[model samples]
Target: MKNLIKINSKINENGSIDFKELNIDDFKEFDYYRIVNPITKEIFYNDNGKLKLIHNCHCYDIWGNNKSCDYCVSTNALVTNSTKKKLEQIDGNLFLARVFPIIFDDKTYVLELFQDIGDSYVKTENENLQLSQIVTQLNLLASKDSFSGLFSHGFMYNKIMEITRDNIMPVALLCMDIDNMKYINDNFGHYEGDVLIKKISDELIKLNSDNVFAARTGGDEFQVIFINYTKEMALDYSKPILDNLEKILIKDNYYASTSWAIEDRIKNQNAKELIESADSKMYKVKDIHHKN
Candidate 1:
């Protein structure tokens, strides 16, 4: 999903996008156009993730779906407050999907646009150009995660290796995970659990400053790499997230118990070793918290 259209110069506080002035004919090049309410998450779908049609759109004609797509990009864009652009393969046909967040009618929504680009691009580009484009596409695929605005795990691993191999100075790694996530999902429902996860991710985003890279490595696990940071400094930085998250409670227990381990970059340490050491420390902290 890419920023395919500049629909509005700025989104207002009420979350309304005014496209009344734009000519719809100019957007005829797009294959599909739809709007989604992100805050409601009340798309035309069953509570159990089934697609159910509630709005009139070209979805039925394009994909034969009366309901929201299972892998809706709007859902993710709202969670991350970021634009989502990607190539999607729908029923063997390829499409370029672009999901953009828009404020409309005092509510947060998303504009979803797609174009069928299956074989057209391949046939249009020359052989040499296609090869170069494929390489660039592969690089992007390895760099960013699809679901949220976080660095990909593979890219994070490469960063760790580069820092350790070069013996970079003033580098530290913090590994953190949400506590009792399964319990939350089971009891509070997955929808609410997803909201909780988004909240946690948002908190982590707040801590993303200069040289601090954050990534989601596991189901409920997050890894942070800090350039020019120490264990104590990392803890100090994470304190705000901890404080902010403490207010969320579940069944009298905190919604999430976060444990992070900070490890310094050393010549002897590799990415795997650093992760292991950090995991051990994080588990110890989590254990103590659970016991208390």
Candidate 2:
């Protein structure tokens, strides 16, 4: 406190002196003074590093945390040029008093004022990343079958409607079911039956093409709907899936049978109704397999 009192007394004693007579030592202990480069917006301050100066006039809350005010236009101008001009003072919550060009040795430096701005910029960026992750999870849950990871029945219907609306032709729907799947679960372990379901779904998805949509619609039941396809095209598409199934079974030493039917002739039926028709036909094929 005694030292501060002495400093203040010295400043008062120098009152009314010509400004040019003052030197750097005159304000050596001044607590609040800043030097900043105008073009880079970089800031410097007195030896204590407590006060930063630039040309903006706003309250602490307005500019965000540690952000200087926006109205420091004159300070910015001085740092960009090489001449001295009369300083101007303007009104605001805070404003720059003057812009001084400091020439040290051969290089030039600038001095400006700064004020605090608030802290919302970083928070908004983090919120965007979290929102993106949520959208991705919701889509996965909506499109997937909970048990088999195949397409859900609702997704299949939506796809059929979407394709048909696009001016496609010769659409066919084929519903399929595993023959005696429940019987296998009753006799063998449910784990073994689950393996069979997974195997069938894998084979079906591998048959994906521009025209086909495959899904496991229910337990032990699956379906494929083909767009822009004829009866012959449907059969040709099914052949690869059937052959793949035979290879998988022979490799695993497990026997599972599936039945599917193409409902291309039923043009009058809507998507759901068409799937039902193919489902009924699939049951007939399953019954024949059972009898044999």
Candidate 3:
């Protein structure tokens, strides 16, 4: 089945399909086919032998998912320029998707061929749904903090490595720490300290979006990475958190306060250096709070 799809179909310099000896008729064996720009998530399909792009239509729309898949095979194929396959469930039916990296108009794209395999693979719709839920839970357990429900420290480290390796620019990192956490724990008890952490997590979660990745990196330390954002923009986005924390009263008139630092990715800075820079700047802010 893998041999049916060619690995690298190239577009000619003149802007015509080279096909690279690939027979387009072989695609007919699949139930449906679509060309996708992995970065933009745009969907394009053949219309009477001509390719046409669908406006505002994403591949995830077919799966009825609100966002992109956590492990996106199409994006993987585009990144590695390799053929990949994954089983996707849509509308209670199983689909086998074979992704092949191709060049269209000198830009990389993925050709996704989907064939329905529900009857052969899935026993019942309810069973499939249960399996999907279990997988989602396992993924959450592996990547998320148990108490705060934000991403774990390990996940944040891996994400930083990915961003650095990929050289994704215009990124900002926000390092945050709850001020006087030990003081709160000693005076109010550990339970109250836990409550304060959860309150801080709730505030951070409110800032989460498609471009924001928030993680609880330590006991009272949180980090947020903003993609495609400048340092100024990231600071502006986080100002509300400071204002909100000032109003949160945990108990006994003690307010939930935090010290944070925001730093933009600099040229040639690795993941470790970037994180260290942010952490150092955060401590400076904490020092100021202590002096007061």
Candidate 4:
């Protein structure tokens, strides 16, 4: 179908749409459409509950409610000023819903799209299924540490960037380093050292939850990001991890004295700064531990 593509959206221009506002006709391509003011839950970007744009396609009934869905991620995207996507089920059909913020008439608006995706992965052949499994395995391997099954440094950094860019507020980072791993490896053997590393990875992995992403950022070093966290909570989390590692026997007269650094996100918009801040704190603690 040919589209009535606009030469320009004229979002911020002087000669914009009538009254510098928008209507349902602005987004005519979608199955169902609405230009929303997230703060007011109305159509169009306005201070009051005034709808500037509202239109529905024939399939609107399949979506259930006439108003916006409850617990919408659109609200989150609006708050964070970022784009968010989610897969939702409605009337036995699956849809990939996207929410993004846009500027219009010098105000903020929420643009939403719901794409149908109910039958995108139905393959009948066994070979095709095996090939799909291989692709999935490859993707997982790319993001994981082969030895410990924890997230690799590269993938962890990528996730940190994603988290920082997203609307996850009150985030905290914890960087940890194992004590004297080289000594353990040199005297006891690399095998025993590997066992200790695996033990640390296992304990760290056990702390995983909906709000945390844990990764092995370096040899004898691990990092975890806690969403909606505080300094006190991060310390509370550290105690359990140290207690768990205390149960493992590294060697006679030898014990693990791990050091950690925790930092909350405040005025930092990049992952490198956040990780470095935590890392610097960890080193200070490690240096003191070594001296004593």
Candidate 5:
């Protein structure tokens, strides 16, 4: 290790290496390691306690469940100690490095090192990066709506196709429009209107059931796709929002009316068609409210 460091010092003019971020070439050049502050969840240092150089990569692309992997000396050291006893004892895939605590002036620091035994460490690094990317993409697909935080028209259509493929279950679609939304935006502010949309969305979220999915279909218009819900359930769920309209207006010092259309699962109905039906109903209801 001493000889390796001595040789590296001559080649590495800058005199620093990021242990956690080491590739095969880097692993070969420098004895790499890491230091992790468990409490803070901060990977403070790499080999020789140096700040790592961040490449032009997004956080999701670079780090997965393994954070501060680039500067992991604690892992390297464990691999080192084990390899010294039996060359064959080193495992290629599974590597665990022991963490050593350095206490100085009431502060404790831990360091971990990596041991390279198998194929070129570059291959391993690339594989890890690929895995990180896949995990990120999967999470994004699962957690977020295709368009904005609201369900996209296309996404809703796809879901409807799947849910109504067979006589599998009953589904209901509730479409809504923010009444006088354009007027509010023009009079009060666009920013306030945006806030109102978010507030209404939040209120809808509070009213959601286990099987309920809410989405923003268009500007000032939203929908709730209810799977296996009865007409009574749909009406009951909507009452909260309708009842709370005055409270929301008073709290925010702005008046916003809402109109809605509801539908139940029927033969040959798709998400697009369902949305259109609800939208038409909503418009009719809106006209009635305006006239009154």
Candidate 6:
């Protein structure tokens, strides 16, 4: 039955299943269906037979996990070229997922059909609110850096990739690293070093807005992404941050300082290249600071 359905289904040029054209109602048994890129975890909802890609959303979002599932049936179906099933439990709700691999435009994708299997129970308003709060807290713990209260490196990387791939233009990448961090940690106590880092992070947090995303990428490294801003505007925005850092006194004589570089998005540049460009320029600034 599955083989006959697969042979009859028409694949559109955009790699979506032409459900209306095929007039196949075999999928009506499933409560909901989604097509997913097994490798990237990119999700697409099947809308009346056409697949519509969901932006900045992954399969993991539903599971509330920081990473991919250990035993992902979608990827497994893609590998084995057969149907697979997994029973998943999320927030006390049970769901059964049927995964099957399909090929379109020479690319393989997984079709996941999900059905709720948990005991039917109506929840009170308070229960729904509690579930919402739990999910929000879980997401925050997954995406936020513990110490700095900023977005984590993994979150930043995924966000940048989403922005770039979606062609959300006029974005700027600003990479910054603390100056003489090793020296500070060695000469001053590590406690003082921690204090300095916190101070810098506090300043970065103040810069966060709807269009600006700041993240603590490493021990002494940070990244601030400015969306819908040109190079000059991003520079103007960052100037006050630099000024604020200059005012942060770690000790009586020494002040906190950072070397930063900003790179505006260019045509055909991926997220990694944009970050590396700013990172390379930041090192040059750091060299000049060292010499001075």
Best by TM-score: 6
The most accurate candidate by lDDT is 3
Better of 4 and 6 by lDDT: 6
Which structure is stronger by TM-score: 2 or 3? Answer: 3
lDDT of 6 by residue, 1-292 (tens): 1111222233345644444342344455555566788668888655554656788777877776776653456665675576776665455555567778876556778877766665533266676556556545555565667899987775677666656765647889999999989888988889999988898998899888888889898899999988888889988987888688755577868776889888888877787789988899999999999898
Candidate 4 TM-score, true structure as reference: 0.54
Model 3 per-residue lDDT tens digits across residues 1-292: 2112332233335533443433345454466566787666788655554556888667777766786655566765665566777766656666678888887557777888877776555567778778677646665565667899887675676566557655646889999998898988899999998988998898898888888888898899999988888899998887877678765688877686888889988977777899999999999999999898
Whichever of 2 and 4 has more TM-score, that candidate is 4
TM-score of 1: 0.51
Over 4 Å off in model 5, which ranges? 1-148, 208-210, 250-254
The alpha-carbon root-mean-square deviation between model 6 and the true structure, to one decimal in Å, is 11.2
**TM-scores of the models, in the order given:** 0.51, 0.50, 0.56, 0.54, 0.50, 0.62
Tell me, what's the RMSD of every candidate?
A: 17.1, 27.2, 12.7, 12.1, 18.5, 11.2
Order the candidates by TM-score, highest first — what do you get?
Answer: 6, 3, 4, 1, 2, 5
- List the candidate 3 regions with Cα displacement exceeding 4 Å: 1-137
Candidate 3: pairs in clash: none
Of 1 and 3, which scores higher on TM-score?
3
Error of 6 at 102 (Å): 23
lDDT of 1 by residue, 1-292 (tens): 2212323233345544354432223244466555555334333322222233455433323444564333344555665677777565444446677777666435566667667777543433365355445644654564566565666565566566546655647678888777778878988888777777677777776777767777776667888888778778877887777678665655455456566677776667776788888888889988987787
Assess each prediction's global lDDT (C-alpha) against the native: 0.61, 0.54, 0.74, 0.64, 0.53, 0.72
Which stretches of candidate 2 lie above 4 Å from their native place? 1-141, 163-168, 246-254
RMSD value for candidate 2: 27.2
- Give the C-alpha lDDT of model 1: 0.61
**Model 4: per-residue Cα lDDT over 116-142, one tens digit each:** 565444344664455445544554565
